[model samples]
Target: DESIDIPYFGELNGIQLVNPIWVKAVPYNVKVVGANNNVVTHLRLWSTEPSKKQLVQDEKYLKMVSKISESLYPDDSTDEGKILRLQQQYLFSSAGIQDAIREHKALGRDIKDLPKYYTFQINDTHPTLIIPELMRILMDEEYMGYDEAWSIVTQVAAYTNHTILAEALEKWNIELFKRLLPRIYQIVEEMDRRFRLFLKGKNLSQDKINHMALIGSHDVRMAHICIYGSFSVNGVAALHTNILKEIELNDFYQIYPEKFNNKTNGVTHRRWLMHINPELVNILDKTVKGNWRKDLSAIKELENFKDDESIQKEIKNMKLAKKRQLIDVIYKDTGVKLDENAIFDIQIKRLHEYKRQSLNIFHVIYLYLRLKKDANFRKTFHPQNFIFGAKAAPSYIMAKYIIEIINRAAQIINNDPETKDLLKVVFVQNYNVTYAEYLFPAADLSEQISTASKEASGTGNMKFMVNGAITIGTMDGANVEIVEYAGIENEIIFGLSAEEVTQAYKANSYNPRKIFDNDKRIQDVFKFIKSLDKDEHYFDFVFNNLLNVDYFFVLADFDAYVEAQSRANKLYQDEKTWWRMSIMNIANAGFFSSDRTIKQYNEEIWHLDTIKL
Candidate 1:
């Protein structure tokens, strides 16, 4: 009966398959439908029969459909086929609203009680249509009028903003919206017109009108709908939320300051730290002598014992044991064996240009060339094993080439006797979630040197920090916050400050070529890249082609990074100091846990408390 109420019955049934746990599915060995001919559809259902005076007077079935539909898609959906999908979204949302109203009535819940029991959390713009959908349910079906339903509807809805990137922002075509949702379009036009009229007598300018208009052009900006419809609108970070208030959605913020808030992102730390490293978790639980699970802040208490040589050795040995487990997996996957004794430097993430695995390679190539070129520079250090695991989004060309270059470089360096002892570079394939658990805890160092302002908030940075590895990262993204939380002496702080980076961009200047010319070490690194004249050449392109275009400010930060890396290599010799830094990093990282972030959100932003599990 509930599925029957949905405008798109088939679509709701599919949603039920994934979402509704009670709906057990029967096996279908048929393979009947042709893949190309068939497509999905969304259903929208309404009581077609005219509402008699008695039906209008009885306020029962009216609000149920409205409430359910609004709850289902309080915002709107954004995908490729805007017209087809918008109709599909509306069908399901409308039926959902209908179902909610019916259930509430059945339970003898009054209109006032609906607000208490029904709280709608609109995830992005995909569900934004719930606004007008509720209005239709209220006014048309129940004869309650528009204004009365909106007040109650807005109170129950909350919105979360996921991305500030313009590409991610959604806008529906005006013609398609009107064609598919004529009644909703009528309400939107009336609302927008009234809004325009509200400001007509005031000193509001054309700029304000252009920015605020809902259905003016094809762009039915979903974020705008989200902000205007809901009582609460939140960004996913302190800095990102600040970006929402101060920059991206400033016009909306100015109109309704109280509505805007920040809820910084949080990972479920249980999966990230505790469950991931059972050996360390067991040690912490046994030695530290308390449950630090809920009160994650209590992990800081472990710092005092970190300096205790016996505990430190035990932790270091546990990391090596994890390394052995990871080595088997790595050898199985990539057919490359690694020594558990060497510096297991790991950089694993999505292969974006901004993340700059190319810079990492350049540094590797630089080290390999120096070992071979410098006659006096004998093998004075433990051989460094550079491990990279990344995947290029099937579309990215340069990223794929970067992968190829790293793989080829590995083959060349791993075989050459002169360079093999000092450095070995390897790119592990198909880096995913399962591999990440093994990769993080085994690392001697975690590379997080993305170009500043490029990475929004790297969850990977926090993972590396709490995993008892020293971070050799730039002062960017969460790395800035990580350095602040960990202290500068505990972690390497290289590259330009946020301010310097901004100023350089503001000046309309930042030359990659100049850095390559002036810095001798940088100059030598590029020269060695060009000097590879082997018949089995790894890189198929000129060295200039690789560094000159320099996608992620690689050449720009080359010297500072090299100098910082030298400091890192030198510090690695003092095992005691390196281990101490690693220990302090893990201890201080308790503050960075998602638990703390969520607590701050409850007190300051959400104004709600957990039921204390």
Candidate 2:
């Protein structure tokens, strides 16, 4: 994507750059942003034949993505990768600045208009050095004075923060910084020095200095730089917004409180709701009496008929039909014959420990053991089709093992005649955005049981809720705001609060061993893994990670999850009650739409006016 260049460059949208390689926008629409803005020109560059370039460079990677049409790219994975990414940033930044100068020279436009026409939004910190890069164009390439270029860079550009996870946040080593981006490093050092002097007169402390240095270090204190340097900054959820201030950015919040804002994330309801489930959409349009398609707040009209039995029956039938369609998909992909009558319990997301597949698996094993021991446990319960869709990061060993265990458990439970009808487990492979559309609408239950404070904000939870699935979640991510929107009774919430998790960590109060030893169900689940004494490698894989590493407190939450799952099953048996709850969830889900989030951003941060044309 990058090389040392004589000219300026900008960016290639990730999708466009990796085109037709994975899932593609089938019928492409050519969108021209402006025919006559009298402003600036930006070129989006791609290899036109990108897959050929990819295959020529890495035949191994090209082969990996063939089955699912997905690629595992790590050309920029190391310190070298970081350097390559930074080089791409500067390439685009300097190119854009110089491109602006060239256009001005040809067109004979006033040079001062650069500020008005040259505003650049660095989508994420992957391009954070762009400010310094732009500075180089002005001072070194453009040969403008230091202060003059710095002024132009500041006025011309801003950034966005994508994630709060520690690993996802990037920071370059000082050595990497010096080797790959020497000139930009000099500009950053100078900026750090000047900022230090500014802080010195204001009576700054050492702690603040260390914090800011790490924040703006070549790795980039991205959210802060985006927030403080840009005209505005915002988070993807209401709770996340408050969280940014209360936790992640507490120091900076005090330093500059008003800068951080909330622009809750939203999905394009067009893709999520309309295109995916046109049948349910038809029923909604007929019953609710308007197209909620354009403005989701119109779903509020559904509140009037929450108690209407006829409408409730229609919604229930519509959901069941969608479930039947999903079963067709399941049959083709995994050769698993699923009963649509069984409760479609689902958990689909990236396979990360913090998302707590361990807790969910413990609950599944606990149920399996209970059924094995108590013969009559089946009579009282509705049969459940526990469906999991996840893809582990190829290098994440524990996550890959988790998938294998889930597959093995599915084989064990599904093949046994006694449990075949009552309980079925299926692990669908290669979970991605395209498959998520099918999973969201077909789900009877959305499992969002991440340990509190771990998931930054789950966009998936909102998607399922909007599709009328009941969420059984924790008080983390967007779930807090979701339960608030849908109201408590409309959804089910379990487990600790973010504050409680933080306090527990501070006190060192959690004990996975004690929890595992006392609860026989949890104990049996662990014992079941170890009792696979027959399968030493698999048990060793599970045990060494759980009992030895034991960091995520999987054992601690196992019982609570079993209790929650049991409660959910009991609710599932009450057909009328479940239908009403599902209705109310969709009715209240308007708040979670990206339309609302974008509107909030346009109002509070970007101040972008709609350019519908």
| Candidate of highest lDDT | 2
* Candidate 1 TM-score, true structure as reference: 0.75
* Weakest 10 consecutive residues of candidate 2 by summed lDDT: 18-27
Runs of candidate 1 with Cα error greater than 4 angstroms are 1-115, 122-146, 171-204, 208-218, 375-382, 392-394, 516-552, 599-613
Please tell me which predicted candidate would have the highest TM-score against the true structure: 2
Q: After superposition, how far is residue 498 of candidate 2 from its true place, in Å?
A: 0.5
lDDT of 1 by residue, 1-613 (tens): 2343233112122112112111111111234442233643333343321123222323433443333333322322333234445644665556556667777889988764566666566667777777777766776666775677777777767788866656456677776765556667666766677667655545569778767766556667666666766888887655556667776788778777998886655555577778688877876786664557766667777788767888778778878888998889988987777888778888998787678888888888777777787866545656788999887655566787778667877887888888776776778777888988988888888898887655556677788878788888877666766778678888887886655665776675777777767777777765555445454244445345544555467888877787777788778788778888877777777767787776765565445544532
- Predicted structure 1: lDDT: 0.68
